[model samples]
Target: MASATNTKIVSSPLLVLLLFSLYTSSAEETGTTLTSSTEEKNVFVLDNYGARGDGEHDDTQALAKAWNAACSSSRPASSLLVPKGNTYLLKPVTLSGPCKSSITFNVKGTLLAPPSRSDWTQDTIRHWIMFQGVSDLTVTGGGTVDGNGEIWWKNSCKTNEALPCTEAPTALTFHQCDNLKVDNLRILNSQQIHLSVEDCANVRVSRLSITAPGTSPNTDGIHVTRSTDVQVRDCAIKTGDDCLSIEDGTRNLHVTKVVCGPGHGISIGSLGDDDSRAEVSGVTIDSVQLYGTTNGARIKTWQGGSGYAKDIVFQNIVMDNVQNPIIIDQSYCDSAKPCEDQESSAVEISNIVFKNIRGTTASKDAIKLSCSQNAPCSDIALENIELKLEGGDGDPESTCQNAKWRKSGNVVPSPCKGSN
Candidate 1:
């Protein structure tokens, strides 16, 4: 997929190889470890810290004590292990650190959240398990994190109109943690967002399986905001909201080799909301497969805001029966009340590239770019795109408004004006 060129397309195998080399080079240069290892790490077992390991008993105190000891240890590399073959119930807890050294929080057993909001006695229950201010941390083990969120879902206003809307707790959060690695974990049935990384740098999340029911409300698989130099690779996500949501103040984010379905596809923003400035740049999402999703490769922003979202690329993507396979909605409004028509200003969107995208769309509108009049989108390039209606008589259609774009190769139902 060459920009501004009519050259023949490269084969898939060669493209994948080149991408792999680039990823590896970046990994090496940044010193981001892709895997978690327990060897050479001093072990601190939870059972030794007075935890009963019973499903009904509260293990929050024991976990706190264990974390304190681990953080205070003089060892260079420490490990906090929750042994396998048991289920431990945890209340809302925050594990903060400016720890002694590098640490690995290994979860080999099932960590179950409180079943309902009534079980939470904290002042506020916005986050179930939060790790804050830690550096050089790795959380991995082939275990399960069960949010037990059915009761919350049933009471959510999004699910039932009778209930007033309220906030639900995210399952896991990493705030201000640098050099973090999270891999080989199963996160299931979260109340809201499954995992969030906020205000962090140099993070790598890979080989994770995150899932929730298709009808569950607001269960985004991974949400990254105010972070930089992050890489997400080799994950499978099925949730109600975006599989990967990249938010404001994020730069140098790369996502590759992900499988997403039964959810909103990979998205950048819903940014610049409430008349605020938002900045996001240098994002590359490549080699992803989406099936039965609401939207694929989307960039959305609210009106009446400032700043810019630019230098993004979505390449080598395949979609199966997806709706809105490629879209840029600059006037996004998720409120229950209708937004006023035609705002004056918006987030400036520029330098977007979509390449090697072949898909079957469930909706008739395969590509929709609805940009703002005041701050129109610019430098949008579409290359080697071929999208068809999944089960219809005619080819899928496209609509473009207030976007300056160009097409190089094989775009079906071309969206740009004067596109051949």
Candidate 2:
């Protein structure tokens, strides 16, 4: 489970009635029914509420006020317009709702974050902008959200250990939301992760461009946890960490038509951390392009952790100069301190399929399955895979330890000899 953040939930019955009256009056005057004109007159403009989009003033309060007005409006649907051609400077804020109606947050301008690390304190929430408990929400606009994360990136332990390590804020976070649609947004240079969807269901994300420097610490492009029926398509992501990460409790996730590079490739797990239970199932990745990544496709779990990962598929992938093109490491450890050698991981992995994967690997060991001895990986299948080292003379090799798999049709470098 992820850490909880403070949310400010507000509603006003009198305000709702007033807005409803105003909406109805406007619709009647315009000779349109309330059903057809609900979205037209229900726009709450931030500029009218004293939001000067000059990129210098803090507009957090102004945005919050606009959110409250829209959320409390009694219309069937309301729009919160962030108009184009201006830059709105903002601080950490949460827009929470068990709203009376659905909302559309139309972002058409730039939202800029503080430039200096000293501007943010540790007690601040780990998110710059958070949407919580909202259903039927659509956040779509051709705009940019700039985190200005250079200072935070410099202070990170991944860059320099002389500075004290602290948590940086995610650029955008959606928590406990359902029926969400996010499209055509550019999220760039976040202090931590770019976009996070946690405990959300029935989500569709597309046409998003998420980018950060390859050396940035912990800057995953999209991280989903405890979510279901999530579909991410037509996204171009370049980040330091995994382009897409599926954490525990996520199911029925489909990712397709993605272009990823200069990052750690798509991954599942590094789960079972601190002896915790982690489970993820029913994930599919198809038609992805990975270039110059640390790892192409991977599943990693730590020792002394219990749970199961099953029914996963990776097909129709194209890798270009990637390291560890295909891998599963049961003894996955990311900390600087050495981990104690354990006999096995308690997590069970089964029913994984990798098919039609064509790639060029930078490492000689292009395919590696290092599973736990006690709980070996079972029911794994590989088909039509062709991986070769980029500039090496020798053929790429497959390394397997306590992994059982079946192969069919055109496998390159051949399967390991000790398969059961």
Candidate 3:
């Protein structure tokens, strides 16, 4: 009887099928599925890993665990999901990976940062959320990251001189990542810069709404440095600092269909500071709208720095109430101490074109090209440019120092010439 029972159990195909079905069902319930070939693809939910999503508790450890699981999975495609209708408060965390396969961080809920500056220690917490060395990644879904930066802003030396000055953490920073895509996200009230892309390649960012108070100090909307093949499109950014600041070692960058206001307008540099070398080339900015900005279409390099900025183009720009609508200031000094007069800046500026720019300037000098004397600007061109001053009569004025350029087609304010 025992032998017959064993034989029946061993030969039961229905039992084997039932066990297989249960395994598959279990896998599906755990946000993973098994294919016919028995390979698993994962969708790791944060809640499953002990994330409260209550907006009060720290979910940093929970998020880290989910990321590690998804990143270590053997799946060809995996996703770490922050599900909708919840807020997850996160402390400073670095999500680092060269994962086994392509991974997506699907954020469908709000992520909140610590409210007070005292909650962050400077050396250890320079960025609220950092994604490093990740490739083939997509961060999407209509969500928000709130930096809760009111206290930090109030403590800033720029806002209050009585407070001691300190560096604030960036809201999101991507370092050494490749083939990354970020879209449909809103980053708000950052302690400092809202988004920073550093040493990355093949990055595409679109449809981002980044905002901070106009009085918020050093709150740049997007800061890209030492990156390549980047495309930023269809973004609306209003912040205290530059809407887009492109730093050294960046190439083949394209910015289009952007709207900027209550911020310093898109800038190529404040490069070569403290005598460092800088290089930027192959940049194009088109179809942009700027309103109530400090500047529009600017390239600024410090006096004592060494580098080159070339092959840049700004076209089809419309500005309203912008100061320094078109500018290239070689002697840009923001320090309280006066910049010493020098013969020239070592940074070479060349091959820059501003075309089809129509704007109203808050300042009388709509276009100011103050290039270095020793290394004068060359091959600069202004075509179809028209600018008028806001709340003032007559055509706007342009000033050029040590800059040589060719002009064609409807330049409203005539450009000044350098004695070459």
Candidate 4:
């Protein structure tokens, strides 16, 4: 409707029921289901930009000649302005739609993205803004898309500082798009992945404000790889590493009331060790809020991994100064030692659930289940989970576990007995 806020990717429940029935149906039924009959497509106008987007120069060919004259406007168009205080130094200009053809980008100006590479290519597609195979696309207002990335996060490690050394790429990607809608943009400083939903479908990302620096290593604040039926709601992520990472061919996802912090909190699979791809099923991360984080809710599966991380759910999350508030690492290794999996498709972290979570762990283990004694972790659930670690009486050579930690009528969380 007229209040669909800003977006990043995945949203199209028939374009939110045709913009809420065309904003309460009037004005001749919102001009018979809008698609721009000048209903609103106000393209760049900050005195035709001489300098203002504050990223300086290369005004991206004058905002890609005003977005190719407003998505080739020939009457029927509906929303594409960026007018606030004006700081529009754009480059990658693409807005494809013909299917249901519903576009909206009010975004009160400050839409910047010009770090070069010929201002982000088109046919070869390098990112900044791209949505091919679009359907009812949306990117709402209260603008800002500053991807000036301080020269790629100060050379994001030229020699491998934990993998994510992008020179300039991925700042808002919507690959293989459909029914997508990215909302309420603020999305700042990006060298790599600040919002990405690949191979999307019926997606929705709402009330967003995805940021960068925390040292800006991989950026990564909302990265759903090989996607399908996604939803990330009420967001406000602080980056520099995994603040919501669902990878390895993801499936029907949902992450709600998010407010992640300082990075690395809400993850599911580093998954890539030849991450077999396809089979990360029905997922959910609810009511999240983590500050000074470092793995508050994680499910990392890998050791030379394959597929199947099914039916996951992490409920009502809240952790402060976390260091591993609640974890499930299926022998995930990064080569300093444990790397030997000749053949083991073992990813099955099944029917997982963690409801009513409450936390405060500072340097490790409030709960850690390092599965895979030979692929052992199935039907896990922990309702009413509470965590409290960060003091001296907790790490007596820690290595917590719960082999069959099920709870609902009996409760059990103590049988991991392997310490360092």
Candidate 5:
């Protein structure tokens, strides 16, 4: 959900595929300019006339009008634009794209969501703004998409709830989508996931501030599932739970240049329980910063589940005031004791590597590995991981056990042998 942008690299893998028609300005990209003076561009301005965020107000109609007007014949090329203005209160809105036409939401104003769940109707039970089957889509600009999450995060309805807390209240959700780019936006505060891109391929998220308070329940920054070829880079995150989480059916993912705090840093999965029908593989994370977080980098799996995680790497990370910098918890659940005992792990963690991570810790141990006794984590390598904990005597009780851990002794990542 976040990233930082340096000068664009000259030739990337997808340059040929990039039409270059979207941004027509020549090389010299200077300071911020309001309008892109190129052809085939659409523009829409949101003023206080119709769009207003008056507490319990619903500005859904105004937003829809703007979207419809932007997509109308004036911008027939489907160049959806966003003009600058103050935050316009709005209900959940859907921004979808067709296969042939690429859409750009040049965020100009903050899109504030409603404060009350009862303000929304039941039929509208999806993300705050759901994007589905979008192709070659780009969401960029210097504005924010504030979910107004304080009220809803603590009340999200789970499957086992008596009365549903709220339904489909994510900040932004994409399902079964392809070729999306989310850049330079502040996507924060959500009932559930801040931004979710599921079942999509070839997606990139950069230069964003995706966050929620650490006490907020289920306020994950970015949750990707059943997806491939995804990259999240160059952003700061402060959230309730996992800053970045990759679930099942995910492969070939990369994360870099991130700053995290007050949350679980980067996580693989609590994979299992038939919740998802896939596995995660071929992931790499580098140049990250973790602060005041629950766990720095983690790979979690259910106690009794199925699947396999392979070919992952974590490199060049900075830790500050974090509890557990490196962790792999194959036994994951909210309950105190293990519930169901399956034959083997529905998901097996293997072939992973951690490289060049340095930082300080506030907890007793720096790293903890807790894989299943039956299906152990294997073929793992941790090289050049330096850690320091200020108050500890270094030799603490066992908090890590199952997985294989090996690394340079500068800052030892403790094994998962002890309980909290």
Candidate 6:
């Protein structure tokens, strides 16, 4: 009996390693971690921090506690895990961080937002989930963030003009972060913009699936503002508004391998609103497909604004039944009526290149460039363009005004009979 007991205890190295892993997993499951003196605890589980994950119970406090512990850990790197197989209901929360080290928020489960506006406090009316002031962070783990925004959509002023127009909360926002990586997330039914990147730098966002109904109001897939050196790629976005909107103060932004449908196509503004100044430069949008979208590769600015949008390239794009395939509307007005014509201080748009663009336009005018009279667009280049009307009617036409453009290669609809 003594010999048999010793044999069982003295197993092979493989068995010993397996036993150790089992023990560690058991400790994690029970939330029994070793002391920091013995071993650094780097993984903070939401369930261990008292999140029931029942989809009904509020998990806000538990999430906050877990984040705090992970953010304050003395380890070189820490991870906060929202484990799989559970749906956590979270109220409005801002996960602010100036972490002790690099942090990773791994969402392997579902994060469900509150069902209605009544659950939002006055201070929390603008955002549902936010991460701010974090650097060297990575957010991934192939999970779902369900905004549950049906109630908010019903109350939208666009849906019901009788209701007072108010701001709906964005689903996920990252503000003032640097060296961030966000990927492999499915965001559904956002209240407003699905993901907003503001004042961030060196960010990479990819492999995201963001979806809302075509009629859902103001649900932009991704909105970037005041961010630098950001890359957005491999995203499939379908929403009521622009698939991607690059606002003012954005520089060196690159977007590729994107699929957009049932929404407004990628836009470089409705910038310079309220007579404010806007500046955007060095933006390249390539390898994009727009299906049944309202517009394609568009730039829209208000009439009475100052600043410049330049050095932009839209290349290798394909549009299917798009209403406005290629457009530059400097007189864009979203107000209830036509904007009061104030052309005194318009935003300067220049050096815009539309290259290798082939598409089928849903409208008779395939290309419309209506630039500001005071600040007309210059150095607009169109190369290798072939756009035809949907259903093979007569060839599409081009409309141009106050635009100085140059064309090369096979530019169909023949470019409005003007040259550089």
* TM-score per candidate: 0.90, 0.89, 0.89, 0.34, 0.81, 0.90
- Can you rank all candidates by lDDT, best first? 6, 1, 3, 2, 5, 4
Q: How many steric overlaps are in each model, in order?
A: 0, 0, 0, 22, 22, 0
Better-scoring candidate (TM-score), 2 or 5: 2
Best-matching candidate per lDDT: 6
User: Cα RMSD to native, each candidate?
Assistant: 6.0, 11.2, 16.2, 17.8, 7.6, 12.9
Instruction: List runs of model 4 lying over 4 Å from the truth.
Output: 1-69, 73-79, 85-106, 109-184, 187-196, 200-223, 227-242, 250-259, 262-264, 269-294, 300-320, 323-326, 329-367, 373-397, 400-420
lDDT for model 4: 0.66
Task: Give per-residue CA lDDT, model 4, range 110-175, as digits (tens).
Answer: 767766555554453346766665666677665678777766666656334675533457777877
Of candidates 2 and 1, the better by TM-score: 1
List candidate 5 stretches off by more than 4 Å: 1-41, 46-57, 69-77, 154-168, 274-277, 335-338, 392-400, 405-420
What would the per-residue lDDT of candidate 5 be over residues 36-90, giving only the tens digit for each residue? Answer: 4433244454332266544345667776776555544344345444444556677
Give lDDT tens digits, candidate 1, residues 119-153.
Answer: 66546467999999999999987677999889889
Model 2 / residue 134 / CA error / Å = 0.7
**Candidate 1 — which pairs collide?**
none
**Native-referenced Cα lDDT, model 1:** 0.86
Worst 10 residues of 3 by lDDT: 1-10
Measured with C-alpha atoms, the lDDT of residue 394 in candidate 4 is 66
Candidate 6: where are CA atoms >4 Å away? 1-41, 418-420
Displacement of residue 384 (Cα, Å) in model 4 is 32
All models: lDDT? Answer: 0.86, 0.84, 0.84, 0.66, 0.69, 0.87
Clashing pairs in 3: none
Q: Model 1 residue 177 lDDT?
A: 99
> Clash number for model 5?
22
